[model samples]
Target: MDTRRLTQYVICVCVILTTVTLAQGQIKRCFACRSRGALGDCKDPFRFNSTHLVPGVKDEPCASGWCSKRIEGKKDGKDHDLAIERQCLQRSPPDDKERCSEALVGHRKIFICFCYGDLCNSASGIKPSFLLLFIPLAFQMLSSRF
Candidate 1:
């Protein structure tokens, strides 16, 4: 192979390898928050009550302690905030609802799956927020490459 061509090939290979390895593999935790401070994650996001997010949306947040998932995807956090806020109302104290509503939208998405009254967002691969994470990453990676 030509020397210059070989180097170019090598670089291309490196880039592909690196990018592919990180290509949206299911993390043991939420892709957004990665279970760092999250109480848990929602593995399956849609099983909840479609009418009520906390019940319909997977990995919704806890009452006062932690939000089911976090948001840091490509979508503007501001946008998802509206949806999260609407869902946040389902919780106990309806006071700080506005800001609490902002947790699930933006360049991120998290869903903590809990079984019986526990943090569910950071649970693991089963969380649906993981899907949103990849959806944007797919778009982002494509855009940057293009």
Candidate 2:
């Protein structure tokens, strides 16, 4: 192939590779569980017991690239029942920060945290990796050379 044609071919391959790499980061496997009354293993003080199987608790792929854990209950009472839910987010939250926020849904108050990365919604809170941020910049620099 000619020099120009070869350069174009190399650029095409690089673009394709970058796209694939970026897409891979968006796919995450997160713990999925929901418990209303019994508290089970889904509540705070989450026990990640792999040896003993727990019903309604498992890891599943999150297509939205975000996972969330939500706890719902009354703010004033210790005796009030609390609900815990961990699942893949249907859509990305407004803020990308990996932190917890308190919100009221009707009469019930909830504390929810959203994060990106595999199983990042665990008891440790959000675990976002900043490494993925450099991929696009690197690709841009590479393409500029051509």
Candidate 3:
């Protein structure tokens, strides 16, 4: 390739990469439920009463973390205790499972766990968030080369 064409190609690749990186750093989604009725009512297969789109923290990437908290306790004295509260946390530890879990603990009779990924704590299953992003990114990368 000629010098000018090569420079253009490099610039194009850089732009594409930058765009993808920025996009990946934003737009995280998590299931949210704060109401007692929603927690008990949205059952069978389990459904989130709603979802939370996390906002970007100052000096941090927007929506880069997904967090869910399930508060488990016993209504009566039985082993069948269930999660009484479930919510999507606004700010969460990023990419650190241990830290997330640790942060969720310290409540009596309440079992809490945190995970990274959209709807990861749902009864259905975890949704593959990266696949959606990568499909378009791969296409862009492939298309740009030609």
Candidate 4:
């Protein structure tokens, strides 16, 4: 094959491989769990250790490429309870970002966070380490061709 054609073929292959790798990276696995009160593993101060052994919490893929955690505080006449949820999102929220935001639902207060990293909706919040780790690998692959 001619030099020009060989170079073009290599570039094309690299592009295709990169695209596939990036697409795979977009799908994230997040923790899915919910608890209506403070008695479950899904509640605040979530234990990150040995989560796989937990009965209610499991990892699920997020097709929308986003994971979210919602915490709702409900109050009755003189008692208060907390509802915690962590799951993979099917659709992106309007204010989808890597930060947590608060809102009022009736008399209850809710704090929801949307993130795009694997298991990012954990108790510690967003995890950008995945992207941070990918950038250098991608750059190395591209640079090695030169």
- What is the TM-score of candidate 4? 0.60
* Alpha-carbon shift of residue 34 in model 3 (angstroms): 3.0
Regions of model 2 farther than 4 Å from truth: 1-26, 37-39, 49-53, 75-80, 125-146
After TM-score superposition, the amount by which residue 125's alpha carbon in candidate 4 deviates from its true location, in angstroms, is 4.5
Q: Which 10-residue window of candidate 3 scores lowest in summed lDDT?
A: 53-62
Kindly list the per-residue Cα lDDT of model 4 for residues 1-146, writing each as its tens digit.
Answer: 86567667656766666677677677778889988764778876777633443878887877887888998775443223677899888888777657778978788679888888777777774544454465566556556766
Clash pairs for candidate 3: none
Candidate numbers, best lDDT first, in rank order: 2, 4, 3, 1
Clashes of each: 46, 0, 0, 0
TM-score, per-candidate, Cα-based: 0.20, 0.60, 0.44, 0.60
Overall lDDT per candidate, in order of appearance: 0.34, 0.73, 0.50, 0.73
Q: What TM-score does candidate 3 get on C-alpha atoms?
A: 0.44
- Select the stronger candidate by lDDT from 1 and 4: 4
Q: Which stretches of candidate 1 lie over 4 Å from their true place?
A: 25-146
